[model samples]
Target: MAMYALTEVTKRFTKGRKEVRALDGVDLTVADGDWLAIQGPTGHGKTTLLQLLGALDRPSSGSVLFDGDDLARLSERRLAGVRARSFGFVFQFFNLIPTLTAQENVETALVPLKVSAASRRERAGRALADVGLADRSGHLPAELSGGQQQRVAIARALVTEPAVLLADEPTGNLDEDTRDEIIALLEGLWKDRGLTLITVTHDSTVARRAPRIAWISKGKVSLRKDDRRAARSRAVTTEPKDADSAAVGGAVATAEQSAAPVTTTEPRDAGGTAPGGRVALPEEATAAE
Candidate 1:
């Protein structure tokens, strides 16, 4: 059985007097322990698809099922539980807290999982060390370079030992030297930790690492199985422009995988922080004050 199955997924949103179709009738099944890469221009709903997969947002239509449970049916509380216990997210910018020490920042992601304070601290330290940041744990974010901080973020994401690592443009901010290092680290983790790594990137080199590729365009997703024609046939149900954009977070989906294409970048916070930093607490999530 597939680890995740998305069927007829459509998402749309409205912008300034314009409707954007971010995802359209997307269908995919990501099995366990698979390394997958999603490629497209910046605004082509790559990030939006990640959001849907991570259950940060529900599909406007269709279904996203984890194991066998439909994410749309999950309450906000349940979704938070699933995210905390099963998913690890890595954004391009290291989303560490400015005032917290590196170790403290990494420890934050573990809080939701109800790990004991002492155990969490120990595990967090080891995870940071794994990324070659053992000594910097006590330092603030400003003290570290961009690459160091991002590694700390990676450490935080992994400390929880989540089943899936969802990274969106994780290498976008680094220079060539650091970029390759981070990629190698991720690949190593993918192999050693046996994680399901799903990354969204415009870089062809990055996408090529994936064993399977899925393309999004219009309001549909095409899976590139053995036959290219079968992929095109799946798009017969693409939605109209208006409904398509507004539903999946407001951009046209593109099935044509571009090795590199110009994309209107999203407004990244100067701090590289995501919109929702705190994982909402549910009963299943262990939250400490």
Candidate 2:
């Protein structure tokens, strides 16, 4: 079943006197339990598209169907309900409240759903354990390492038991080693929980991990199926000098596999007019709060 279906979706922003179209006539469908990686240059509408999917923002025109309901037509209250109950989001920066303990940070996600305090605490504890952060539940974000803080953020996102996970630049701020650890954790969670995972990343290494890749350019999108299974097999079987070398080798192998013939689907009228200027939007603040 299709968890999300976007047809002729376009998002526009008014900057000065000129209108900037971040997403132009985008058409894409993501199936339930599918993993989709979106990669594109900065200011090219990757985040705009993700915002639409997560119900953080509405489109300027066209339909954004989530499980057959048109999000564009929904009232703001209904959209907020959908976001609170159906979607979980992890951002690039660990957006944990500095004063809150790890468990407390996670519990906040349940507050909007009106979960009892005791139940929220219990669920938050379990979520931290799921992300391998149970031992650090009492620690503040300042006390934890970058990787641990990201884990706490992940835990917070999952505490609501959302059906879809929307992550934007999830590993962009971490070291390569930490990035790998976080990605592994997310991949495991997606498989075990049957989550519909959608991640937007600029890193090719991260993008290649997904079974399907959506390349957005000039507010247009193209979808391609990747042979990640074969690439993973090659990475595991090959021996490298060190861990870093192994990762690089794996990326190379994945790139090679991607170069091979694969099925690709491009949106109708994919060509879009380039924006005269780009506006940097603020990070999404709803997920953790």
Candidate 3:
């Protein structure tokens, strides 16, 4: 099943009396439980496109269909509900609160859900454990290593049990070893939780790990499948539990054969010249996470 279908999507921004078209007539479909890595040069549309996918920003003209609903037409309240219930996000910066303990930071994700304080703490603890930060739950972000802090950020993202995990430059701030560790953790979570994973990254090594890679340049996107990675995934998980599982597997294989350009160029910042700020969220929600 397709988790997201975007068609003719365009996003425009006004900066100092000039108009910037961030995304230009993009059409793409992301399958459920699919891991897609987006890469591109600086000042292109990678982050803009990701913002659209996460419902952090609306398209100027066209449909962004999550499941079957058109996000472009949804009210802000409806969009916020979708964000709160369906999507989880991780960012380049650890984005943890300076004063909050790791546990408290993870618990904030549940605040908008109206979870009781006790329930929030319990779930946050479990999330921290899942990310291998159980022992660091009481530590402040500054007390943890870079990798551990990212793990805490990951825990906070997953505490809500969202269907889709949207990450923007998640490993940009880490060293090579730490980056690999975070990538492995994310990969495991995507497979174990059946998440629809979409990551915007500037690292080619990270992009190659995904089953599908999407490259955006000059506001347009092109997609290609990573056949070698897909084959490896199939080999490791041979037995489909049921007919439905087998069918979905077949569909993914078929989709992989559809060709598009594959870029071997080194990844660039992709942050572009757009304005910088945290993702838009309600006051109670952590804007950066």
Best by lDDT: 3
Cα RMSDs of all predictions? 13.4, 6.6, 5.6
Q: Kindly list the per-residue Cα lDDT of model 1 for residues 1-289, writing each as its tens digit.
A: 7889988887767665766667767778888877777765445566777878888778778899998989978998898899888998888767678989999999998887788999988999999999899999899999999999889988988998899998877888888788888888897888678788898776666666565565544434555422222222222335547864555522222233322233323322232211211232232121111
Encode model 2's per-residue lDDT on 1-289: one tens digit a residue: 7889999999888877978888889999888877899976676788888888988778899999999999999997898899889999898877888999999999989988899999999999999999988899999999999999999989988999999999988998899999999999998898789898999998989988887788887787887665545534563475687999888877777777767555445443336543423222232353210
Model 2: lDDT of residue 44: 75
CA-lDDT, candidates in order: 0.72, 0.82, 0.83
Regarding lDDT, does 2 or 3 come out ahead? 3
Candidate numbers, best TM-score first, in rank order = 3, 2, 1
TM-scores for candidates 1 onward, in order: 0.76, 0.82, 0.84
- Please say which candidate is ahead in lDDT: 1 or 2: 2
- TM-score of candidate 2 relative to the true fold: 0.82
Tell me the tens digit of each residue's lDDT in model 3 across 1-289: 6889999988887888988777878998998888899977766778778888988888889999998989889998999899999999888887888899999999999999999999999999999999998999999989999999999999999999999999889999999999999999999898889888999988999998888898887677777555544544574668899999999988776665443346544334445453322355553232231
Model 2 gets an lDDT of 0.82
Question: Which candidate do you rate higher for TM-score, 2 or 3?
Answer: 3
The candidates, ranked best first by lDDT, are 3, 2, 1
Segments of candidate 1 deviating more than 4 angstroms: 16-18, 224-289
